[model samples]
Target: MKIGIISDIHGNSEAINSVLKNIKEVDEFICLGDIVGYGADPNYCIEKIKDIKCRCIGGNHDFAVAGKVNINYFNYAARSAILWTSLPLKKENLNFLSNLKRRIELEDNVFAVHGSPQDPLLEYILDKDTASFIFSKFNFKICFVGHSHLAGCFSFSENNNQVNYMNFSNGGCIEINTNKRYIINCGSVGQPRDGNPKASYGIYDLKNKAVNIYRVSYPINLTKSKIINAGLPRSLADRLSYGR
Candidate 1:
């Protein structure tokens, strides 16, 4: 099965639209959450995801918008954006966000979560120590997550019990070593923070046991204009091009 993995689509419909156009042949889509927040067009983006019927989970932003979590931990801009996103959302979309799960297991061995396994909706696995700890907490061979909005992989080799962190390369394809376990960050759809301006996504080919990362350039100006017009923080609009 070929699965398209997307996450942190924080309401930027343009970015997600570009990604959908780029990768259209996937068998199933696994969304890792943050379906709304930080950008404009929350309803539009939510509808797009709903139309596809992608398996999704609640993100921190999603929780905040759904009033499921406190926005106290968020910074000024993020808090402001979440507040802006909370209003004007459709009832169905709000319910979808409200009912989203934190984590899921697919294909028997593949685990999916919005955040780290240790803390499904919040903690980020940035370093080897955290990654090592996560490896011990989950029993799956392959774990996929999003939230950091950075595209990459962390692999723990069973042979040496050593770990390696690899950034996505050109063409963005990584060979999956079934003998070892891996934790992959599918990156962000609406807001990418990997220093790359393009939107990021991933494809997991279960048949080949390989993961392919992808990035698509969308109309940043369009989303930015929408954000500004929506009365959201201008910083929210400005950040799209910078990918901060």
Candidate 2:
């Protein structure tokens, strides 16, 4: 089965729509969350994810907008976005975000989380040390995470007692080695931070035992205009151009 793995949608409807259209051929979709912050379309994104039956996990921003996390946890722009996002969200969408699980386990020893397995809603497993420590905390052969907004993977080989990080910032495919465990980040659909402006996603093929990261262009200017028109932070709209 080929599962489309997406993370950090961040309320950018254009980016999410483009990703969904591009990955529509996959058998299923799994969302790593952040579905409701930093962009201009929380309700639209939520409805779209639900419409496609995407299995989702709660992200920090999602929780914040749902009133499950303190707004103070975010910075000025983010907090403002969170407040703005919350006002327009349907009660059902808020409930959906509020009830989302932080972690979910799939078949084939695959696990999914919005953040690191240790702290699914908050932690950013960005380094070899953190990945090494996190490896001991989860038994899954592959743990897919999003929150760092960087497309990459960390593989730990028990035989060599080594953890290696590979950057897929430009998108690529990696075969899963049974001897090595992995922590994979599919990057972000709406708010990429790996210096790549294109929307990012992943296709995990169980039959082939490979994970393919992909980047695609979307209508960034449209999203930026919406952000500006919606009264969201100007910097949020500006950063979309730089992918920072």
Best-matching candidate per TM-score: 2
Report every candidate's CA lDDT.
0.88, 0.92
Model 2 error, position 41 (Å):
0.9
Single out the weakest 10-residue window by summed lDDT for candidate 2. Answer: 101-110
Estimated TM-score for each candidate: 0.97, 0.98
Indicate the residue-level lDDT of 58 in model 1: 90
Report the lDDT tens digits of candidate 1 across residue range 153-192.
Answer: 9999999989899876223777888679999997898988
Clash count per candidate? 0, 0
Span of 10 residues, lowest total lDDT, candidate 1: 167-176
Residue-level lDDT tens digits of model 2 in 164-216: 99999899998998799999998999999999999999999999999999999
